[model samples]
Target: MKFWQRLFTAFLQRFHLMRFFGRNRSFKELHQSSYAQEISKNLSKRLLNASRTQTNDLLKQFDTHLTGLTEEQAHTQQMTVGLNEVTHEKPLTWWQHLWYCYRNPFNILLSLLALIAFFTDDLTGSTIISVMVILSTLLRYWQEAKSNQAADALKAMVSNTATVLRHQVSAEDLELMHERYGIDTKNQTTHQFEIPIQYLVPGDVILLSAGDMIPADCRILSAKDLFVSQAAMTGESMPVEKFPLQKNLEETSALELDNIVFMGTNIVSGSAQAVVLSTGIQTYFGALAHQCYGY
Candidate 1:
């Protein structure tokens, strides 16, 4: 029994290692020859390479490190990177993408009726149908135009990337990374004497921000007077003042706890690094991107 238990434990440990750190990851599959080689791939090459070689190197390092991710981690990384770059094509001066939705069918049907009336010499009925078709066509055009505008507004609010300290192991380095590396460190803690946020469980730190709704439930680990209105999640009317992270006490509810912040709450003020606890449909946003897109 003891031998079986030991062997089972070892097997579980090996799977855990591969599932998280991916210590056995084969870098050979992750590394590309060089950025220059990748640049020749196509159009985004310009936007991709517009940054300095040093910037490209940083991105390269990120990708290489991403190689240590489990299958799920790799998918999330691909989703968040450069999400703001717009690639949709613009329509002609007067026509929009949705314009065809309104114009095509009505015009075609009315044109056929008009042609049939012309052959039969029934000018009055043909004229009335023609007018009706024109009115409907115009209405459809206007409807599509308004829909496009609203969608654009929503897209404008979306955030593509969050600036966070990718490596923060101690409060000392946490402070330094913010000061020097341009990394934000508003929410943080020391766990087992090292910064706890750095030890975030694999495949769980990401939460949607920017225009996207928050992706999960979380607490503020580093709050610099940050405020969040969790009305969507909690039905509060005004934005709540975010407090410093604190240990949970029996008397403290999730909302009253100053140190903790829930997912789906907007970042109302200042800046922060939230410690994500739950995500996806489990979060207040209640929705997550179901499909993955990568370039």
Candidate 2:
């Protein structure tokens, strides 16, 4: 019995059929592993090179179609992979902000001078320097806190919503649609809806038009003269044209792949339909954000 079990496991591994046998690691398990970061980076790289893959193959990997993902599937994916939002650094507390303000070279020099003045019995000079340091630190802290609040508000307004094709079925028609089509009722029809970008997940099919920000890293399914401004990522002033992958193309950098669009970029002209490849901290933009936050 032991020998047979070992043989069966070996056969499944050799055939890459462990997933079918329910032996594959769950998202939660992988996420909690020590190699999570390495796995995430590899997944991002794979999606970035998706331009070299066929559209059907890419769709199969994501378990989605051009018609988009069903509401239930999207919800499940969200729960598994987490939200399509970047993690931000914790805001500095008042004391921390004050410390930062006082830690500047100018403030340090002033503090040292004030201390020296006190030791030299120069009461008036020390008092003036101490007042100057306090006033400067308080003023700087207030200005920085206000600026941070304004920046947060602007960011909230900017990333509000995204247009995606979601398949939703009424509860009453669920059985009828399932019986008639002999398919998951959610796949029967797709409807365009503007949903909050934070609710977005991998496998979503999104529509892009001029002025709309790309919600997540996605592979282009079909495009029509699609032009995108990659200034946010590449600092390129000129908008680059993008299109569907008609053939396998080798590229040195993921940015050079015209078939994949990244989050944080916006459409400059024309339109496109793309399936989400990565989201949240797993996306290109999110990775950059993670680095910037020193995570």
TM-score of every candidate relative to the true structure: 0.38, 0.69
Cα lDDT tens digits, model 2, 1-295, are: 9999999989866544454565434333444455545644675468656767788888888888778887678778988998888986556667766776777789999999999999999999999999999999999988998899999899866646787786654665455434532335454444676677887888899999999999899889888989999887776789999989834365545776878898999999999999998899888777666544334
Query: Candidate 2: worst 10 consecutive residues by lDDT?
Result: 23-32
Instruction: Mark the 10 consecutive residues where model 1 has the least summed lDDT.
Output: 286-295
Candidate 1, residues 1-295, lDDT tens digits: the string is 9999778768755433223322321222212224223322431232222221232243344342211223234335535542222123234345433344444665788879988997899998799888887788777778877887898899777533332233325566556545633445667552111122222232333332333333345544445666677675456688777554343334223345554454446776666544343333332222211111111
Model 2 lDDT, residue 100, Cα: 69
User: Candidate 2 regions off by >4 Å?
Assistant: 1-45, 120-125, 171-190, 231-237, 249-253, 289-293
